[model samples]
Target: MSVSEKATIICSKCSAETDFVAWKSITTDTDPIFKEKVRSGELYQCICPKCGNVTIIEYDTLYSEVDKDLTIYFVTNKDSYEKAMELLKSDEANSEEEQSGVFRVVTTRAEFREKLLIADAGYDDRAIEILKFITATHVKEVQKIKFDAALFDMQNGKYGFRFFETGKAGIFIPMVEDMYNQVVVDFSPKYPTEEKDNLEVNLNWVINIVKGNNNSFI
Candidate 1:
């Protein structure tokens, strides 16, 4: 279920036009190796035959994990990104029949990677994002420091997170099970228990909570 298009791309280094297979959609169930290629960052890379230079293609692709019930559509082009947003907004009342699993709309390459990693690890990416938001709020309240980014990491059979501070590139603050469990416990009430068919609907709830609308979020 990996969809691709053949295109004649001009090599930036040698200016030689060569045919390349550009992947537009990838399904982990069918093309398993593609997931590894994504992790290695070689799937979107084209090696020029003439100059031997690597050219990175920035195009939109849908990354789907059927086993994990996740689908993330990534668009980098401005027009496509805006159109994707508009489509998602129009499908606000997205029917259960129209969905197979967690259908998330993403606009960046980093987000696409993060969501794919989380789904491959058998965890819910939306829930993890909510947990990160709560933990970031606590970090700011307690340590008086800004938490910029975080990614789920497993170390020594334990589920943890690696955090980055504002303006820091490689700064990581590792968290243990106790901290993660605390966030889960705190955010439990905000979870949408009724939407068992679509658990990610609660992501909007978490976003509203982040926007300072505690009572009206739900």
Candidate 2:
């Protein structure tokens, strides 16, 4: 189900108010046009009628793909996460049916897009985040800057990334195939599960394992 409503947006360039449609939930299976807009990131994008300024109107939205077996609650604020956690911990959360596949909570437009890209690439988003963490931290010359975006090239088996420096986006860095493969191989074994129900994984869950923090999440 795709839910939308008309809303007003202020233009950054002219400080003029404009009206646009904002989506509250996006189900990719049936509504592909909106889905394409999500991929292209134009669903709530608004152009100022007065000054031609472009901006995106962001709000809380649930992104789901039943065929892909993925559900991500994209929350814009901390309160939403707390509320979502409460829902996840309810009796419905204990149902065997609900526990069948990946369930996650993500914040930020970038992470929301990353989830879609990762699923499209037939790769795990958590694994890719770990790779991002490594790239942003351990790598030497690359570590000198912070990357704002990462795009995976499944065709070439490479990661295409860009960074924001002085309001400028850096070009794609050289592909690191070895590191990607190494992370996929090395990270999976950290928590091995024979059961099919346990296929979904995330960085927070991994962090819990490393920190010996035992908290229940599905």
Candidate 3:
């Protein structure tokens, strides 16, 4: 059986302390290992009931040497996140640009396939354009992408896509290395810093995935 613990968190927006059950291992339909990482302390996130915000709780300080008590350092803006979520939920009814927020809308699977066919076609432009389209249509969905899997793991928690093998529903958009353009430097203060490290990594991985050199889904 998996063990769990109760943790208390204070809402950054409301300043109300709420209690949460921190699971040691939460088994789900997709990605069984996700819970293992959380149990191992490799990942940390929580949800606030008062404001209904799913916050990324950081246990250790960014540059702190001493081990301090784990605290709720970051509380995500639930308003925007939830708005983007609505767009994703209504993807089929919405246009390509609207679905862009939930998933990348390529012209066609052949377009992605052609890139794979080319000798030196890179994913930099394609990925950026797809992400940008999604951002422009549903700005909130861009932020909620990080928490979608965790929040909906039980129902349809598959990350981006189920697999890249072969099927219809369009090509499974692989996880790009630097998929994130902005990094949350501090959640308590609700500050964001532009960083390109994630984007660089995403490009490298997308290239490999398209070439079939790597099978690890982003």
Q: How close is candidate 3 to the true structure, as a TM-score?
A: 0.23
Return the TM-score for each candidate structure: 0.75, 0.70, 0.23
Mind giving the per-residue lDDT tens digits that candidate 3 earns over 1-218?
A: 33457788888777778776554333233334532443344445565777776666543211110112111111124553344345434635343432111122112223222222221222233344334333332423543322111100011332232111233232233333344232111111221121111111123333433354243222
Q: Model 2's lDDT to the true fold?
A: 0.64
User: How many clashing pairs per prediction, in order?
Assistant: 0, 0, 7
Lowest-sum lDDT 10-residue window in model 2: 192-201
Tens-digit lDDT track of model 1 for 77-103: 889877766666554645435555677
Report RMSD (Å) for each prediction in the order shown: 4.3, 5.6, 19.2
**Cand. 3 Cα-lDDT:** 0.33
Q: List candidate 1 segments past 4 Å from native.
A: 91-93, 96-98, 138-148, 153-168, 192-205, 212-218
> What is candidate 2's CA lDDT for residue 193?
50
Roughly what TM-score does model 1 have, to 2 decimal places? 0.75
Best-fitting candidate, measured by lDDT?
A: 1
